[model samples]
Target: MSIRSGLFKLLGLCLLAGVLVAGIMFPVVGAAGVISNQASETVESMSSSLADEPPPLVTTLTDREGKPFATLYEQYRIPTTSDQISEAMKWAIISVEDRRFYDHHGVDWKGTLRAAISNSSGGDMQGASTLTQQYVKNYLINVTYRGDELGQQKAQEASLARKLKEARIAIQLETKMTKEEILTGYLNVVEFSRQIYGVGAAAQAYFGTTAAELNVPQSALLAAMVNNPAVLDPWNNPEKAKERRNFVLDKMVENRKLAKEDAEKFKEEPLGVLPGGPDKPASTCVSADPAFGFFCQYVEDHLVEDLGMDKDDLYTGGYVIRTTMDRKATLEAKKAAEEEVRKDEPNVANTLSVIKPGKDSHEVVALVANKDYGTDSAAGQTVYGLPYEVFNVTGAGSSFKIFTAAAAMEQKKYGIFDTVPVPNFHVSPVFNWGGEHCPTRPSGVRTYCVSNASDGADTSMSLQDALAKSPNTTFVILEEETGMGPVVEMASKLGLRKTMASRPADGRQPDPDHEKPEYSMSQKEFYGPNELAPNGRGMFTLGASPVSGLELANVAATIMSGGVWCSPTPVLEVNDRAGKPFPVKEPECEQVVPEELANTLAVGLSKDTQPGGTAASAAAAAGWDRPMIGKTGTTQFQGSAAFVGATPQLAAAAMVFRPDIPYGGLSYGGPGNVHATANGNMFGGMTPAQTWFRAMKPIMADLPPEPLPQPDPAYTKMR
Candidate 1:
């Protein structure tokens, strides 16, 4: 023999001796409770343990009616059974990866010996790993290094130790599983491409076909990609991919799985990879359909925040989530908001929320916004949902007057019939206490002006009539007499503050004196203590507090239910992979006000929908024959228009505003324009009332009608 050949032989013998010594020294406990010095024995222990543990599966999300709307996954993989895999795919993989797969035990001693000889002689090193060993390596990499970049690198390090461990594990795996079972498991767990795993996902991603439908050429291409996915990506590197595919085809023919003529024919054929990108599955609410995106996000938030579920499990644990979304109601709400709001005025936004009213009413039937529920790059807006009750909060305008009325009756200080002077404008002592805007005149009395929308002549009207007219002067006088403490408490008792800022103790509105250079703070911050101190403001009763649309809806629902407030819930049920039921929260009901007082307030507020009421036009537009109670509200300079209405069966709230424009008293103009009002000013009775009417008309059309509870005789007697 030549000197180089002799040296290589000696080196190979030394390496074999070293491997034997290591195996004897590292004897491991094997199956059947037997201790063995064989290298396979150590592998048996580790492989069995690893094979029993699998990675987390994908989670599913469904709507109320059990229709799947979205899916969440870390790696988009759907496992397939052996029977579902094509024979072409199976032969293609086995021929290229392990021609002797069924002929040998997992270790492949002959191949290993040949590889050792070639490597020692400095010849082109050949891989001796069998299919089982490759599977073992992949399994180890996934279990040990998932979500860790550095750990994955280390697990894939081309070292003697890693190879030895893989060999041992492969040998043991062969003992536990049949060849077909191992092949199926291997195909299910292997990574195909970026964010894509398993043969099922790969087949669909590459050809838009299932595993069982993959033809011979397609199967050969996929099998070739297994060796070097990045380099052999058919779409990116067609030349290298074609070469690899032809190699796999030749191997199949060499192994007698395919005829020589067929192999040659496939080689001449074009790499007919269909034109498409990877099939990346939706993993979050942002990727959901526009109609369901907002509701999906709400459900995800509830799962993570309220229920304290792990976010990782939410994306991967395969838990089935079912939400309380009524598809028809949700679509109608969206349609109403979109149709009622002027599409030409891109700046204008409208939001609507609907909820059932009863002790067991926990589901938020519909929550819709005018804007699409995703990023609007052209408009420079990230969040697309309106100021929803739980996520975003904003001003409610005169819609809050119902709370003031509830407080008055709850305190027994004033009944719904209590009279107050309705004037075009009025001034108060507390208004002059804070600023120089209300200076003392020659009469020696400081005056704060409060104006009504109608600019009507001085007249005294019952509290019920004042509420229907939404006169600022009357509510201010009533608030002064009843005190702001009771009004704030009444709002809290309902669900106004549940998802928003609690009422400040001092009851102060934004101060005009401490003017900041930037006026970009949210409407909630303007009414919150951030911009204002805790002292009573004259305009407190005129709906200065910021509230969410859902908050207003919940308040209306509470009144509809005659005092009982049911905390809003979004999800109805959750299930595991095996369809086993999981615990779901029930509606939490509390009596926040007396039934008599609630009924009295509901009856008084219903006057707003009367022929002469502020929202009369909206009621006329809705054209409903059922009994309905509602209130209209408009903020200072018409910054926001709002309406809260309810029937005995359902309650809803709608609001229209321009969030992009700061709350510096900008008015929402009439149809087709946002900065200019055709009627000279925007009111709750215009856009918001119209939105509420259109949305509620369809939603309540099919529901059974129930009469509003009659006011207490004692309270009605005072009128």
Candidate 2:
């Protein structure tokens, strides 16, 4: 024999002796890390981790109706208990993988000795790992060294030292866990196919059944695949998989786990796997329905940011998340949005959000966008969370007028019926025009002047009438009359907190010429004590800042709920793997404004869909006769348009803007020319209000119309 061969055999005998000692002494000396220096730390550290750490499992997200729509996972695994596994599955795996599983403590010493001698002789290297040893190895690879490629390789390396390390950990595991638990853990953490892990997920993927329901033949096939999942995959190598499966069945019979006659009969049966292939369930927001994908992404962000959940745990914690998404409502809203602004309309995007209003909770029911939620930008699909986020949409336009009106009423200085001047154009005395070329006053100050949407609004009218017409000059004048601070504060209080606090990264860079670059900040910061545009400016009332469509809908919800501001939450419920209720962390509902002020504001805004109102034409077209309050907003340059409305039950906001042109405005007659003119057709009342009425008409069809609260005479009448 060669010297190398002699040395290998001698080393193998030494390892065999070490393993024998470890098998007997591991329970006592194992705690002291007396195993070899190379393996002591690895075995000791990994043993406790195996006992303490649970394997990565799948997390499912369901709609409000409790139908699962999306799944999130690091490893596509579903954990099952010993009782949840079938007897056939346990026996088949043990019979083929380790025939003397129950007879040995953890390591089968006789098999190990034989494998050691054979391997040392340079024949086909064999694995003598018991189920517990395999469990420890799998746990180390999947859980302990999940992302560490080097650590995974070390756990799987083919060496006597590695085997000794595994043996020591396995013996320790046997003392801590039962045989059934070890079997279950091994079955769960083992890979059955690409991205498919665990017996539970395997059963569902292979046979469209649960682990507990797996029959003998099905269990045998899965057990056989654990040896070589890629090669033994039934979909690709059916003949080989069948042959391996039959071998497992024969071994089961030899072990007396299955009857010989039953094994023979089962061998003739075909692999009854689910049709087409393994039923690998699609995961992540990208795989969700186009109509609901945006909302699914929104819920994911909300869970991490507001609920304080660890992002990694969210994917592997096996949580069952029940969200407030009304699938039907979401589908309908998406259909309406796409119908109004076709999904193929590349530049423009129409976004909508719906909230169920309440004093304690404002449940977000729907978030829909005209564009399909996906990564294929060329196909008119977007991955941006448009409905819930500000994104590239310019501003909410005259939507800010709602806050101004609310602020005015809250101050008790101006009532809804109190007359406010409406002129063809008005010059502001308090605000600077900045870079805009405005007419210089006699004092050489550039006057900030603004005009109404149309050329024929030179008359004084009540605040309620002015809101319906949405005269730009009136709201800007009102913002000056009512301090800008209160108006900005009202927007924050009425559910625009996130919108006002968002510091968009684009266009915030400091001047290149400046010695110190000033970073761009959020609207709230601009209105605060910051040196950049402190205390806000004149255009605040006209909604000249980017805003969240979801929060705008929540603004209507806040008003509909009589001044209570509740953070809009998508999660309805969450349960841990143990099926215990997980508490959701959300901002508490607070009364931001007086109940009477909100009620009075709602009554005044109710005229928006009435005769001669801006949204009157759209409301009439939709046959909208329900008792509702609404407001329409069109940006100064027609960059974006928005409509916010609410009933007693539901509140919604819809906006239309050019997503591609963040710093630019949407012209009526722009490229793609679906429906545009130089300055004729793009107004909040046109597309956005039409979209709102089109969606809300069907949503509110079955609900009874509830009347608004009586308007407070103090806000309705002049002080």
In angstroms, the error of model 1 at 649 is 2.9
State TM-scores per candidate.
0.83, 0.89
**Per-model RMSD to reference:** 5.5, 4.0
Write model 1 residue lDDT over 1-719, tens digit each, in one string.
Answer: 99999898788788775783464245445652344454454566667765666555678878799888877777777768899999999999999999999988787777776665565556532378788887776666655466788867755665556656666677778878889988887787777767667788889888888999988898998899888888888878989999999999999998899999998999988877667666656767777777677777777766776678788877766788887888888889888877776434566667888888886664688877776666764542235446363322235678878877787777676677777678776776444332345568565655566667777654887778878987887777767666666666677678775433432211223343544412333223433233242334455566644566877888989988878888777787889766798776654689899888888888888788888788897788778677878898887667667889999888888887665543333434333234332221247887778888888888777888778899886554343
Tens digits of per-residue lDDT for model 2, 1-719: 99999898788798767766664453434645443544555566777788777888889899998998888887888779899999999999999998888888888988777776776667433478888888988888888788899999998887777777788898878878888778988998998986889999999999999999999999999999988889999999999999999999999999999999999999999999987887876667887777788988998899997678898889888899999998888888988888788788767888899999999899999999989988888877998888888763467788789998888888877899989888878888877664365788787757777887778734888998988888888887887778778888889999988777764332232233544312255666554334544435777777766788999999999999999999999999999988999888788999999888899999889999999788998999889988989998877667778899999899999988777763444444352223522122347888888889889888877889899888888779875
Q: Candidate 2, overall lDDT?
A: 0.82
Task: Write down the lDDT of every candidate, Cα atoms only.
Answer: 0.72, 0.82
Q: Best TM-score goes to which candidate?
A: 2
